[model samples]
Target: MAVALPGVVEELLSEMAAAVRESARIPDEHLLSLKFIFGASAVQALDLVDRHSVTLISSPSGRRAYQVLGSSGKTYTCLASCHYCSCPAFAFSVLRKSDSLLCKHLLAIYLSQVMGTCQELSVSDKQLTDILLMEKKQEAS
Candidate 1:
């Protein structure tokens, strides 16, 4: 069987260009209008956050707080406010955009959903019971 040779750079470039054109529904002008602000350099960013996996830590009070990897200070924060991931990607998005529902820093939230880790898991038994009671009342209605 004969193997086809790799396409020439020109051919590859054309293919890439086509793919970009077809896949990129957003116009260059629109994309260019968005500034890319990042809190950390790419390398530093990688070290700080995990692309997958959400870890949960529980406080002594039995309040389970959630933690996803956050890129900051050349190391992962391990745990940060779910509302505010300390990763540079999050920082950049906050600085560059006014409304962002999800950024790379929100990977923890995604991971939590995927991994079925609840941010409220750390809540005290009384707190959890209260929540359950509230839910039950809502359901009964």
Candidate 2:
């Protein structure tokens, strides 16, 4: 899955990522910048990060997936490489009306990845495929 941030947002996020990667703390300016750009979405994403709801699942062959436990208690799978998330917000906001760039799940995943706070789980390739398939099935229903 790929991230769907606009070009300016993407560049800013990259800069924030670099700063966090080195300092292990989010710079206030960057945080403020995100808030200025994203409003409540940014705050919700920070809350998700605080909840530690983001997980990175990797297989032996390097296949990966991002799982986000929403406040609603349902797990959403995010394809960070493809910018896909099995969540209604992404479907409705990003793909349908184009009202937003991406959902909070995607933002949470990106921020957690940069902050090095995402929980990681290793599995076999088969297991990875199974997990992804289950998420997709849920989406269909």
User: What's the lDDT for residue 24 in model 2?
Assistant: 74
Q: Best lDDT goes to which candidate? A: 2
* Clashing pairs in model 2, backbone N/Cα/C closer than 3 A: 1-79, 1-80, 1-81, 1-82, 1-83, 2-81, 2-82, 2-83
Model 2 TM-score on a 0 to 1 scale: 0.90
Off by over 4 Å in 1: 1-52, 62-64, 70-82, 117-141
TM-score of each: 0.33, 0.90
Residues 65-129 of candidate 2: C-alpha lDDT, one tens digit per residue = 99999989999998889888889989998899987777999889988877888999999999999
TM accuracy, model 1? 0.33
- Over 35-86, each residue of candidate 1 has an lDDT whose tens digit, in order, gives 2322233223223223433555454465443445444312222233434444
